[model samples]
Target: MDDLQFLDIFRGKLIKLTLKTSSYVGVVQRINSNKTVLLADVVYVEKGIKVPGLKLFFGHEIVNVEFPGKTNSGDRETLGYKLEDHLLVEEFQPYRKSIRLDDDEDDEVVINFEVIDEFHGKFGSAVMHIKKQRLIGVGADAVEAFQQGRLCWLQIATKNKVYLFDILVLGAQAFKNGLSMILENKHILKVIHDCRVISACLLAQFGVRLTNVFDTQVADVMCFYSETGGFLPDRVSTLQEVVSLHLNVPSSQLSSLKMKSQLTKEERELWYKRPCPLPLLKVMALSVIHLLPLRLVLLDTLMTDYMDLVDSYLSSSYNEPGEVEHINMELASSQAVPFFAAGTMQWRHTPRLDLG
Candidate 1:
């Protein structure tokens, strides 16, 4: 039987769903007309840990389904633990809190956006805020803006505040003030998704070299290889895909954001407009807001699940022998390495050892 037929049979029963990225076990609560399955009381199967909240899975995401056997109604036990255990419920509450890009909806994050233009005061304070933060999320709009001989908006996000720098209005003054110093600083950790375009633009136009970068794209590729022991050099995941996989952001929300952020020929011209549209500015801000939190989640998984690969990749980035041991200690203790240290490292092929 196909996925829909299989789900129909297993309604209200405990089953394990094998998805492309991860596995989950839960009761089939409801099946929508669109072939989407609502799973209640979900437990992340790989870690054998229960996660609070109901999870919705699309038909395309279900790779395979296995009946895990009848659920014990007396004590509500499955996999040797009570599904309603109070202690376990409290422990998994934090996992449900995810970074949201929605405007004015997320109370957990204090997202403040400022338009830095000619009238905006000196950029020194913004640089000071960045230097004070342990981690920074950097994003740019219209990656080809520099190559096309135009200006792009640059977004820098800390834990609470997001600064949207109007490069067009500020011109070279923005970089001269302090942008170049931070971008080239090797000590401050900046989480950027796919730095190739940004790196090229900065180097060519501003005469600044981006250093100490944590490329989320490369990190995702590493995580994929670790899980499957398979490497596809040609496969590069989009930002939307990565966010969905790691953060569990709903497909509908991502689809809406994607539609809003699309830069057609006409939309591309908006970047050069004197007063950039609010909708477009919001999109740019939203892009980088979740990056820092996403990095934490990815790093936690990498350090726990694939330490060897982490060691190899991180050690390759730094030259000092002592630095590697220090980083390894941090990983072992589940501490986030504040900086990438030396140079950015790409994921390289490593031979898989056969345990059997």
Candidate 2:
């Protein structure tokens, strides 16, 4: 298989590509967009086409973009003429999983969970073959993603070659790490950092970082080294530190004894600035209640005030359609299960069961 052509996933959503071969700069409107073909706006010397500055004097000509890394000197100079600068962009979305298509003989077939689990045994495995199929299916997706060289470029040079423990995975692990630092029942600044990191990492692929009040490496994760007292400390241990050490993680994990503070009771007033329960969880639960076709307002969110809020603001509004699905997905993830007794019930109905 042509690994190079398979680089479509690397084809960014809305990349700002500059034409290397031409006299004028042309902006790449979209590549790997959901549309069948890409649309680009050229600004240089082209005619006939109407752009603010560029005209398609000649018919459309396909200009190539050089991926940021690993370019040879000559090619770099040619593509370099366009210059490298950050551009606003959107992430590419995969086609819906429910869709089906004609198969190519050489195409590697992947099995999704729903298909395998459809038949418990006769078609599935003897000792839970359906589950085994699902594991294989998901692994295949990861592998196929790798086979196409689409693994996160950030982690490529790292030892494990896996994306950093993302917030979800990190949060799952956090419970094991202990609640002294983070809490499952609440939204910690660290958790917000995780969300930002995941989103930033995705955006960073196109060379972007959404700078906010949170420091680099996140507030909770940063360590500090004080010069005056010859000591090291946690950046988020106080609000004062939050103001000063806001530039990414403090120098390093270790602090020198030369800058030690003589104070005994380490006070941290502003560390946990917002003591908020996961209200977003409530939003999430209500969404699942709305989206899941189950005919039950019997769920907790179905009965709660959150339902009213979602009805007016989000759950009711029709989106133009795209990555906005992530918001819905985040909402569904908020509360894994809802309500009590019948309200919390989640299982296949007994009507389908054969008593015999």
Tell me the alpha-carbon RMSD of every candidate: 22.8, 26.5
Q: Best candidate, lDDT-wise?
A: 1
For model 1, residues 308-327, the per-residue Cα lDDT tens digits are: 76767677667665544433
Candidate no. 2 TM-score: 0.14
Q: Alpha carbon lDDT of residue 270, candidate 1?
A: 57
Give candidate 2 regions above 4 Å deviation. Answer: 1-41, 44-81, 84-356
| Cand. 1 Cα-lDDT | 0.65
After superposition, the stretches of candidate 1 with alpha carbons farther than 4 Å from their true spots are 1-109, 119-122, 143-146, 260-262, 307-356
lDDT of 2 by residue, 1-356 (tens): 46445545443222223344553333332333332224333323332111332233222443554343332232222323211111111110011122222231332232111111112222223223212211110011111112232221111001001111112212222223332122122222211222333333333332322222222222222122112111223122321222123312232211211112122222211111111012211211111111111111112322344555565456434553343343342243323321124213332222211111
Q: Which ten contiguous residues of candidate 2 have the minimum total lDDT? A: 155-164
TM-score, per-candidate, Cα-based: 0.56, 0.14
